[model samples]
Target: MKSRISRLASVMFIGAVLAGCSTFGNTFYTASYTSVSDAGYVIPAIPTEKIPPQYRRQIVNYATNEAPGTIIVDTKSKFLYFIMPGGKAMRYGIGVGREGFEWSGTARIAMKREWPTWTPPAAMIRRQPELAKYRNGMSPGLKNPLGARALYLFNKGGDTGYRIHGTPEWWSIGKAMSSGCIRMMNHDIIDLYERAEQGAKVIVQQ
Candidate 1:
């Protein structure tokens, strides 16, 4: 019985050590996916297991000619990459526009807002009359489509009417179900919001 107890303790110790190593080595995943309370709202933790590994946020070695701080949206892959210096990037999974709603272009982040109000565009309300009530704008809350943050995209012509914004629908990541705006998990968007600069260049690739 004593020998069995000793072996059990050894196994427990090894498991603890391995778990610690994983936490230390992957702090990005550990810290980014957890529940967060911000601006009087509590954002729930994401079910990491439900999300595929490829769609999770991570720093990767991305070879790109674009300068650091450029936001590149590869819609085909459902990945948004924020270029970093020395051939590296902070990549996050995203939900893109559906078939007929897809768009590709260069734009600048004209504005950033936290806990932003969501106003359904007139065209959107026309398609979904139920959204007519929100045409004036929906108050920011847990149920708001624009979750924790929003980065408004614009160009020389003016507002592109598109956004890189957080979504309450976390499961939508790595899919094409939006209406032209790029959607991200609330936690991931909060992280990106902190890093993204106003007026930064954004490239959307089909």
Candidate 2:
């Protein structure tokens, strides 16, 4: 009985040591996602408390044929899925284009930018002539429409003039409002920008 007790104590000690090592290593494992803005004097995370609970970011069991790392945007559900290994995905609430401005199809991320500039397209300027001043492109900053980061989309033809971008208007998430771009919370976009490669596949589903 004494020998058994001693062996048990030894096993417990080894378990404790292994647990300690795991804890120590985890301290250095930086979180890939955060709410802090990637630029502009460290903007605070969006006031998620005010945002509806349904629109909050979450991990979900998502069944799909697409491979891991593909990005799928479902306009009807207003959700974006970052496919992960296993039948899971990191899902984020998103704001998509309004009815007339909605787009659908496959595209690749042609480029990425931190604090990208915003230039009102000539077509937009034609409708809102007051925006003509920014036709040359607005400089990147806090007030820029592109927010903290942007993933520019490209198709077979060329630049689609569409993007998966950050927006300061966090409340707009899960709503249809943008002209055509997919907008995420400023904090969420920064996290995505880090994971999404330049040539990553992006599918917009109407």
TM-score of each: 0.86, 0.81
Error of 2 at 69 (Å): 0.8
Colliding pairs, model 2:
none
Tell me the tens digit of each residue's lDDT in model 1 across 27-84.
4332257688898889998887888777788777899899899999999999999999
Off by over 4 Å in 2: 1-37
Looking at model 1, which ten-residue stretch has the lowest summed lDDT?
A: 22-31
| Model 2 residue 154 lDDT score | 97
RMSD of each: 7.8, 7.8
Model 1 spans with C-alpha error above 4 angstroms: 1-31
1-206 per-residue lDDT for model 2 (tens digits): 99999999999998875552322222321122234534444655556457655566666789999988999999999999889899987777899999899999999999999999899898899989999989899998777889889999999999999999988788889899999999998777876887788899999999
lDDT of each: 0.90, 0.82
Q: Compared to the true structure, candidate 1 yields what TM-score? A: 0.86
Relative to the true structure, candidate 2 reaches a TM of 0.81
True-vs-predicted CA distance for residue 34, candidate 1, Å: 1.5
